[model samples]
Structures are given as C-alpha cells and as structure tokens.
Target: MRRFWYLPLWLTLLVTGCAGQAERGDSLYAQLGGEAGVDRIVAGLLWEIAEDSDTRALFVDTDIERFRNKLAEQLCAVADGPCVYSGDSMRETHRHLQVTSAQFNRLVSSLIRVMEQEQIPVGPQNALLQRLAVMHGDIVAD
Candidate 1:
C-alpha cells in the first residue's frame, strides 16, 4: 500500500521533469560544454584535417588562424551557443576548391572522431551533425 502511494508522486515528478526539459530544450549547447567545448572541437578538427591526407590538400592555401576562428564561430552558432557566425558562406568559402564527396565524407568522419575524443555523447554529436548537414550542398562543389 505504501509503495502504491509513492507511485503517483513519482509519476508527477517524472511528468514535471519531462515538461521542464521540453521547455528549456536549448541544453544542446550546454551539453557540448558550451564555449570551451566548441573551441576545443574546432581545434581538434583542424588538427585532424591537417594530418588527414584525404582532406589536407584542400586547405593548402587556407589561412589557418582565420579558418580556426571562423570554424569555432560556426560551430558555436550551429550549436545554438551565444555566438554568431561571421564567416563567409559555405559556397563562397569552398568556391574554386572543387571539393569531392569523398573529401566531404572524410571531414565528417574526422569530426566524429574528434567529438568522441572530446567525450561528447553520441546524441548531441548527432544533433549537431544533422544541423550542419543542411549546408552540404553549399560546401561540396559537385
């Protein structure tokens, strides 16, 4: 009888907690560890890209410092963090680069690896990727 009495209270709290999450759903940014996390992700990605032969040639002429800043800004903006992306549009940035689909996939793969190293749970990583995927058309020159 006492266990049954606690059931209703537990149900009430569960419902309230679920409702609160829905209302404050911007936790994705926090889940990524906020600004510091985004910055680390961008840095790790840059290092990965530099070392990965599949995508290294694409950035041969890129100004790395500028690329790093813009990338961090883009990640922050995409994750709904408190930063606006001030970089050029993907099409403009990739213009004249003839980025292959294979290269694009390699970049995505690199990001996944970096996120895993950053200890970002799969869900937030997927959410961020899904959002960023929308820009694929603008990035690949094919």
Candidate 2:
C-alpha cells in the first residue's frame, strides 16, 4: 500500500471574508516562511514529485524551471503574499492531463511532506492547503 502522509488540519481556513483574507495574506506569508521559505517549500515539493514515480509521469513533458517558478508564484499568491500567479487557471492547465484522484492525492501527500521538511507549523500549513483546496475540482479530472 502507498504510504499516504495526509493532513490532520486540512480545510481549517484562516480567513472568513475577503477583507480578512487580504489582511491575513501578509501574516500567512510570513508564517509560511515568507518568500525564501515559500521558495524552499515549492522547490522541495517539485523535488518530491520528481523523485516519486507515481507522480513523475504527470510532469514528464513539463518544464521543471517554469513549473517551479509558477508554483512558487501560485503558492505565494494563495498565501496572500505579494507574488501574482501568471500561470493558466488550474482547470485549463489540467484539462488535458486526465489526472486521476489518486494522482491528485499523491501530489497533495508530496506537498504535505514538503511542508513538513520545511518545518512549517500546522496552522499555516492548514491555512495554505485550505486556500488551495478550492482549486481541487479544477485540478482533478472529475
């Protein structure tokens, strides 16, 4: 069986309103280790995916550098950091991938592992994942 390192704090959203989200962005960004910390986590996650055979095929034809930059941007943006995401929407990006639920779950596991490696605290990690959870429908080929 695949070892799944899932979240115990998933969906614990930090903000309840748009104003709150805007206010919490900086705090969340700082909690996520700021730009440098975010960079490290994104890099680690990309590395994790690259090393995992189950998820590696998803990026076989992808540009690692671009993926890294865009993911960093997206994560930063989601955490209410100063970065703007210049990549395509999640649905558009994954439209052709036919990504399975298992693939999506594996990627999330990789992300959790990366966050753990970064020594990120549970609250910020859950907040970040909760924010990104909105994109799940678009990312997964349902």
- How close is every model to the real structure, measured as TM-score? 0.85, 0.81
What are the clash counts of all predictions, listed in order?
A: 0, 0
Q: By TM-score, how accurate is candidate 1?
A: 0.85
lDDT of 1 at 27: 71
Compared with the true structure, what per-residue lDDT tens digits does model 1 show for residues 29-87? 88898999998998899989989987999999999999999998888888888889999
Q: Write the per-residue lDDT of candidate 2 for residues 14-52, one digit (tens) a residue.
A: 334546766755588899999999999988998889898
- Against the reference, the lDDT scores of all candidates come to 0.91, 0.87
Candidate 1 worst ten-residue window by lDDT: 21-30
| Candidate with best lDDT | 1
Clashing pairs in 1: none
